[model samples]
Target: LSEIYPRNLMRKTAKMGGLPSPSEFVKLVNSSASQGDIQIDHVEVIAPIYEKWPPDSHTRIFLDSSNKTDEPVYAREVLSNFLSRAWRHHATDAEIDQKLALFAKIRPKCDDFQEAMVEVLATVLSSPKFLYLVPPGRAKRSGKSGDGNRLAAWELATRLSVFLWCSTPDDELLELSARGRLNDRDVLVSQVKRMLADPRSRRFSRHFVRQWLGMQLLDFLQVDRKAFRQFNPSLKEAMQEEPIAFFDEVLKHNHSVLDFIHADYTMTNERLARHYGLKDVYGNDFRRVELDSTHRRGGLLTQAGLLAMNSDGK
Candidate 1:
């Protein structure tokens, strides 16, 4: 039953009631359900399962299943793999050993192996190498000759991922980077197209539009409730999303840039459609809809959010 518990509800409970131990949390849930507080008809409670104990098949071969004899070997492998992803490059033997030493020092104080490993992993994540887009002195200090003048393949991949996905490079991008092919003209263009086709590229649209159009103002801008009784949070959220969705629509279709100034169609969802007094728009998801002159709306200039956020709420 605990496995089936919604993650968000657990987070909410933690926030409101304070964090509880696993047993205490299950007890709280059971007590709530039994008292008709949770409103559940059925619950089959089961003991907690430790999914990480056996380790998955990809990782299993690195560990000695019978005992802790191969723990150091396993730890080094884990750190190396983690560094490759987090640092966006291969970890040197020295780097791997440094983390392994940290794990060894922390293991004696922690209750279990997993806890100490988690601390080591956290240290890796918090590293300057992991935090910065391209860590200072890396290009100039790298072992590769002539690297000081230009970005490394791995650094280029990281920048491209940050530009398109707003996240770390996936396996494919990392592999291309590792092979030093990410900078090739044809390969770079192909990867760009591939990245744009990915769902993660939506982050590019959302973030680029927000920054370029100064939509961050809308985030903290307070709409006066008394002055605009019909302006609710849902409508405000729809307004905030409109321009990004509108930009994405034009970009995906390769429409003319002029559409931004005066498009015959606009992206909208139910809440925003209602605000614009349009009919037949359903659901929260934004989609392109043909516009008519009766709506008296078109382009980024006509977005409700841009107008409202720019106002003093009078």
Candidate 2:
């Protein structure tokens, strides 16, 4: 599920700490954990080792057979085979063919075929078709299995992933779609509940309050520095986080929405509690503190987030 980055690839190379043969490159790219093993599925040309072959080195060019003086006829063949294996299920023959043709078109202009294939690989990575999960074919009145109109398995998986995890489908979800088993309501509900239970669902609170109070525009508010010297960067960060934490607690604990107005408890870390004149609270952990009538800190209005956002001066 993780995107492969050049830095991580380089780190793996360093960990190996030796001149890498083509087999080593194959091992790195085709490793199960990296993008999953491709060897069992098909033969693949591992992307060129950048350090072993400079971007346009003569040796690299010679490998692709574009040098005409000395070239490997199997270079393009190997690259095409590798790409097809790596992207086996996701890309169609037409798509792979298009990419191979791109390699052919660029090979004459470039010094080496490996370099040309690098350009092709870069294009494949950046292509919208590769990066985005697009459902096959145009929208139709009826879907597979004679449903008059319903979301396809892939589309449903995408919606469920974004709603629950706020991200794209992982291998499990994608595999479910590939097997055509993501349509059950019970299964979808289970996934939704699981995702909501995850810590990342705190995003819900952040998005809700930001829109509810229209505080988004306040980013441009110019504070009078001399008037509000107490408002430091740490205080501002604490203010934003306090309400978000509180709202998350409410959701996690299934507390009534009315608690937002009537509950005496507020969340605060040491720094925030000190700013709010709450005594004896220490450390950077948020804990709920019950408010007394004398404190007048019953709800979010008394919280640092809203207070800071609403404060004009003094």
Candidate 3:
């Protein structure tokens, strides 16, 4: 009866209470269950079962498990769905038919319908029509005749959102463009403010700071061991994170940009804190610490990262 105790009961107990010794707990539970004082209706099994299939066999068994046969019309529907999602617009009847014809040509060579669909998806993803941002209809001049073409409202909105927010246009921006109101100053400004307020705007600050400080190459930069024996891989990683974390706090909390030049508070982890001669710091996590003028660590130039990078080889 002790051997009959369900494995899942032991697992659940361990998960909920935190297992210190799993084997001992399991043995104890099994012994108690086998004493016949407690009734055991069922034993829970937790181990996963493995199945072996042929190397060439399609793992997606559901693809042809249905008695329903593949229809040409269904292929067209699949193509339409792909185009709609890829282009973010409704597909024309001619476009759908053309894709269906391509699918029909490729379907016979593939053993399964899913394999045929994969081929179509690959083609669609690779096509210039899906990859490039193209304006609908013919190119027309804006104000100058030689300028070629002006960006459509949707294109302009998408470009602006990607530039400022580093993401796709949100529903509000998309709707404004769809309604031909995206270019309106008040509407555009409102959308801009909303976008900037979103969490995605942190990407802009991260990108800007990384590029401005040349910290983007920190990963590839080689550290001199003779000059700074303390600068190991972990120390280098902490150094990279310290500046970014400090900048993020300043931007998120609306601190002045000048604070970066001479902020009283800066980020430091245990390794970095010790490296810079900071006291009362422990653990691997980084935290902002206020520095007094007497400490003489007022700016980023005084930080260990910059000092290590600029030091002469010993």
Winning model by TM-score: 1
What range of 10 consecutive residues in model 3 has the weakest lDDT sum?
27-36
Model 3 misplacement above 4 A = 1-101, 111-114, 127-151, 170-172, 197-199, 268-271, 277-288, 295-300, 306-314
lDDT of candidate 1 over 106-183, digit per residue (tens): 888776666678778888889988888765354334567645323477788888998999888888888887777887
RMSD of each: 7.1, 14.0, 14.2
1-314: candidate 3 lDDT, tens digit per residue:
34432233444332123444443334423222112366767646453323554222333322332433656755666666567545544456877787778778877877666567766777777877666766645433345642322236666676766667776566677677777787788988888777767878768766876787777566666767887676666677777777766776786677887877787877887777777788887767778888877675555666665555454433
Q: Which pairs clash in model 3?
A: 2-30
Model 2 pairs whose backbones collide: 44-82, 45-82, 61-112, 65-71
* Each prediction's number of clashing residue pairs: 0, 4, 1
- Against the true structure, whose lDDT is highest? 1
lDDT of each: 0.76, 0.60, 0.64
Error of 3 at 153 (Å): 2.9
lDDT of 2 at 62: 33
Off by over 4 Å in 2: 1-91, 103-151, 285-287
RMSD of 3: 14.2
Report RMSD for candidate 1: 7.1
Q: Given candidate 1, what's the lDDT at residue 43?
A: 60
